[model samples]
Target: MPHHPDLATTVRIRLIEPDETDAVAAVTEAAYSHDYELPESYRRSLLDVATRAAHDQVWVAEDPATGRILGTVWTPLPGERISPLARDGELDFRLLAVAPDARGRGIGAALTRHVIALGRERGARRVVMNSGSEMVGAHRLYLALGFVRLTDREGPVEVAPGRFLDLFAFGYDLD
Candidate 1:
């Protein structure tokens, strides 16, 4: 893919450093809130996952000019064999988001590709993400990137009265 100069020229993706944890959490909360009403506790739980070694493999895309985080994706490293769909291996992608003001500049796609590359390098057979069904745009992007719908599961939490989340699990085979 040709890199777009207008989309923050010096953008780079790197492992999340300890100091950027708060910024990562803030961006995740802000980004998700745009599409869904996440409970404070859920947001906090997401943030807390960054602190746990076994569950954390976060990456942040930063703007080189101003040193601001443009987007981030949290991917868990490959672990015990999980399922047939996880045949290649598994890297659970969570909390992927681009800053609101930075949308449409390809940051989200760039981040997704970055994580896929990371998964390949780490010997992951596949990369998976659970996205809300209502996030049509994101689902489209995932499909565009070669991710196939594996299954759908009910979200663990309900954000509205009589309303439950339908989370779609998508996967991309690395090999």
Candidate 2:
């Protein structure tokens, strides 16, 4: 995996340690729950940081001075992709969430910037993520950060048995 033990970000971006799994999971779930009515399975998935960490790398954005986690996001290990939205040479990230209380502090943006850096460092031609249509704020952020909508990848994703969420795809070209 790529290591950035000392990212010089105002909001420190680093791996989510074992002890912080609960905190990060809470932030992620709370952030999403505020906007949507999550099904039991989806809610459980949001709270299961360990499984995400086991599959990819879970990262947290923290208040540098206080060491408090403000947000969380996960990306597949270098040269890997967890979301089908990503094609070869693309790095895909998912579950980006900033604690409701921490919004407007740029924690989300910082985490995204960190992910972009990770993609560039890993020699990816692009970085991609899929977001639900309800996440308007997140869409603005992605666009402001230079991500473009990927119409071809937009579709409905099953969040639970016989249930679905309309997802839109976005990509940041790093080339």
Candidate 3:
């Protein structure tokens, strides 16, 4: 439960450029590990920003004035396996990250809204996403954006040999 100041007014959502790949990966890994330690598999996935950008849409929330990437999100386009969380007919946004120091600036929400808009533009019937149960702030944001708790999709996944993470799923119907 970190407190972020309200500063979404200055963030701009855009696709990440090739030169910014390392920054995007670093931000994503840092954001997720803020609450818990990441396992090897999870770490590998987070570091694979380039592969994700090649197959799907990798977006970042940037500070227009400073050209800093404050946040990042990955959207799975149709027929692309950008994320295991996404299924057919839906756009799944995964690995949403707002830098620890940048949380209060509304960067996470901006990246999320950008993904939802991408879903609509791709003619998706709905939007889907998965978040760690410990991410209370992100959960609140998703609920406020009209995403509902999909209890049926909730489950525990082994992130490491003896450690498991319970994932919470949320969905927003496009209708």
For TM-score, the strongest prediction is 2
lDDT score, residue 39, model 3?
76
Give lDDT per model, in order: 0.74, 0.88, 0.82
lDDT of 2 at 68: 84
> TM-score ranking from best to worst?
2, 3, 1
For each candidate, what TM-score against the reference?
Answer: 0.80, 0.92, 0.86
116-152, model 1: which lDDT tens digit per residue? 8878888888888777778888988889889998864
Query: Please, what are the lDDT tens digits per residue for candidate 3 over residues 51-160?
Result: 98988778898888899898998876565645466677788888889899987666777677787888788888878988899888889989977899988888997767
Give me the runs in candidate 2 sitting further than 4 Å from their true place: 1-10
Better of 1 and 3 by lDDT: 3
Clashes found in each candidate (C-alpha, N, C closer than 3 A): 1, 0, 1
Candidate 3 structure lDDT: 0.82
Global Cα RMSD, each model: 3.9, 4.6, 3.2
- Displacement of residue 46 (Cα, Å) in model 2 is 0.1
Judged by whole-model lDDT over C-alpha atoms, candidate 1 comes out at 0.74
Count of clashing pairs, candidate 1 = 1
